[model samples]
Target: MELTAALRGQTIQNRVREVGINPNHWYPVAWAHQLPPGRVIPVVVWQQSIAVYRDTAGQVHAIEDACPHKGVELHLGEVHGDRLVCPYHGWEFDRSGQCVHIPYFPPDQKLPCATALSYPAQERYGIIWVFPGDPQLADSRPILEVPEYDDHNCLMIPITGVFNAHFSICNENTMDVFHGFLHKDLQGWFDPVLLNLQDSNSSVQANYRVSYKGTLSKFLGLSTNSDGVTTRNVSVHYQYPHYHSTMEGVSSLYLMRLPVGPNQTRSFSLLFLPKVRLPKWLLRAIKPVLVPLVLRFIFMPFLEQDVGMMESEQRTYQKDAKRRYVEVNPAIIALQRLILRQYEQFMQQSSQSNPANPASQPPFESWQDQSSNSSIEPLTVPHSGKGQ
Candidate 1:
């Protein structure tokens, strides 16, 4: 559905900051290349601890991080052939997370049924994606497509990020183009104006027209030179847990989000700069070096500043959850609405479908209200081996 692109002060929804992920989509867990064959990589998606391992044939599988026997972390185990061997005992679990072997078991005794939770996992765009939702819906949904992946003119740079903020806050930071002021010293874009905005139950898309005039903008091919003023249209599209933004035709960014918990988030991003691509052979030869360098020098600075501000916002929010905040960006308001709506939908479905499942909605009454109290339990982040 279409939404008005006009910028106006809209009422803010504080609940968006208090909700959780729907867990019904393909979320990035780790970089595929980082998880080598015959190795285990533990990650989390919305608090679901998963141990991702690649088999001998280079196939990825995601299983419950905890062993069913003694609750040992499966990532501490080893990968042999297509099965993951539990370290505590010689139990072997297959790709389906089924315990198929016990080294000490008698030949006449049937293997005791043991199965760990498994998720539908796959690889694309040099990243590992896991479907944390219903396994039945795995094949029906697809990862966000990046057409530039096959284009030779684009130099694809895969970047990873860890943010000390809620996924909603991180997402809002992405939808907000007006924050360019924060990057002024770095020669970031300026004079931002929201060009268009649209939203739905599952997504929000926005476009902004901004002026660029600085070395950093020129380096990104956004302007002709650092001294000259160049106006460009930047479009940001958020298809729920993932993002695809483009700066005219110069470059594109695909940010896949890993919402580990309420306050911690990680991102697997691919930055494609069509302007940076050179001769095919030379580009291919130096890409290994060039990609990391550009990501470090050109991108990390902006991200560091953004992360600082995001963490600051989260800290403030934690202190006063009931604090009324003012926002001028209509796009941000729309994005917040979408975030809150998704959580509400998930809550609604979970209530109606899983009446008997007690562990559906988070335990709200027993815990102190974060909005009312300053302190709460630290967020749980399994994949990154960090606690929020």
Candidate 2:
């Protein structure tokens, strides 16, 4: 269904702030390079803690962070060959989360029916993605496509963002191009006007005509001269679990959000600039140094500013959920409505099915949890243990 693009002064539902994610898609969990071979890194998708490990062969795997036996955190364990070995009792679990070994058990003894929940895991575009929803749907959902990733003429800046706000807040920040005023001192953009807006069941696209001037503008390849202002179209597309926004191709950002819990969210993003295209071999050689420089000197400042504002919104929302709010941007209101509706849909499905052990779907509260899991016990291993 297509939604109309009309800005109005309308109040929105506060429940949007509490909405959950549709877990039926694969979400990027960790930086590909960060999880080295033979090492395990713990991550959380929704509230479920997962132990992501790479075997000696550099293959990535994600299993429920908690061990099936004794409820110890599987992340505290180590990766042996292709299996994860529980630190508590040396119980070994394969990539499928099946316990394949128990050192104390005699040979030929059937391993206890102990298996940690495993997610559908894959590696792409230098990141690890896991399906946090129905295992059956993993194969059908598609990951965001980026053709620029391999193109040499593009300068890619990989960025990591940690937000103390809900995913909805973070998402709103991305959709609202009018917030460029927040970066005025840095010469972000000015005179923003929504030129077009369209939405569908899977996406909300907002295009704005905005003027840019100053050093930041020049650095972003927005204008040939800093003293002159250039008007361009900034289109932001909220594609369900991830985002892809482009400023007339001068810069492109792909924001993959990971909803950690109610109060926090994380983003793994890749910013591609077509202006800096170089040869493939040469670009590969310089990417290590260039990627960080652009991220630190160029992108981080904007992200930091956005984070401050996002956190502020979250803090205030926490203080008063009933506070009346005013909204003018039709795109923003539509965005909020779509968010709330998705969650409501998920909740409706969950309520109608009432399946035994149903896992959460979205709207954050609809589906019941079907997986057998446990809570994380802080200090499960000795506090003085290695790497503590």
Candidate 3:
């Protein structure tokens, strides 16, 4: 549904900082290239620990990280053909997580019914993804499509971000374009105005008009003149556990989030930029060297600043869980609502299916109170002539 693009004070939902992820979506665990054939690596989705391994046949599979027999971490084991052999006892498990062999067992003996839970796993866009929810829902949910993944003409740079914050906090940083004030020194966009807003049960989309001026802005095609301001529209779309944002034909970002735990988050992002005007062959030749240079110089600085802010926010939130703050961006409010809604929906479905499982209940009681508190001081927006 459409939401007004107005900037007005709203109480920041303290509960948003306490909510957990809806794991029904696919989450990136690692870059596919990082896990070679015959290697096993450990990963986590929400709190589900998984061991992902690539077999000699080059197929990827994921199973519970612990060995069923002795509770040893399976990642410490080695891959033998299509099976993962536990390093401690040589117990072998297949892709389906069933114990297929125990080397010391008699030739005709029956093996114990030892099985570790396995998850649906696959690869797309050079990333390994694992489904940590209902197995039946895996096939129905599709990974976010990126048309630019195959567009060789665009310069694509893969970036990894680790933030000491909740996924919701990391997400808010992406949706809150007004935070450009934090990046003003880096020639970031300013004078922001939310042009459009759309919110749904699973997604939030926001378009913002922002102005930029500086030599860096000119070189990035964000400004026509180095000294004059240039205005452009940026669209940010949050689809449950992932994000895709674009800057008016100049750049596109596909960010896949990994909620490792409540206090930690990781992102695998593919940033695509228009190729510099040059001969096709030369562009291709320099791309190897150019991608790293662009990442180290241009993108890292912006990310570093963002990381600092996000981590600081998390530290403060951790110190005082119930401290109330004020937010003016409708887009951020919409984003927070979507995050809470998705998690609640997941919990509801889980409760209906397994009513007796207390694990299906909401993680905390405080975030459930949506009503405003009268005792706390409302955060006051600073009147610094900057967009709030």
Candidate that would win on lDDT: 3
Better of 1 and 3 by lDDT: 3
Candidate order by decreasing TM-score: 3, 1, 2
Q: What are the RMSD figures for all models against the true structure?
A: 8.1, 11.3, 3.2
Candidates arranged by lDDT, highest first: 3, 1, 2
Instruction: Point out the higher-scoring one by TM-score: 1 or 3.
Output: 3
Q: In model 3, state the lDDT of residue 67.
A: 95
Residue-wise C-alpha lDDT for candidate 2, range 1-388, written one tens digit per residue: 5444455556655777887877878899999988889999999988889999999998989999998889899888888999999999999999999989899899999888988899988899999999987688899999999888887678878888999999988988989987777876666776777878888877888888877776676666665444477888888998887999998859898999999998999999998888664667787799889888877886788889999999999999999988877766667776776777666665666667676745464335433322212242211111111110
C-alpha displacement of 147 in model 2, angstroms? 1.1
TM-score for all models, in order of appearance: 0.90, 0.88, 0.93
Please tell me which model should have the higher TM-score, number 2 or number 3. Answer: 3
Model 2 lDDT on a 0 to 1 scale:
0.80
**CA shift of 194, model 2, Å:** 0.7
lDDT of 3 by residue, 212-322 (tens): 777666667664644477888999999888999999968899999999888899999999888356677887899989999989998899999999999999999999998
- Supply the TM-score for candidate 3: 0.93
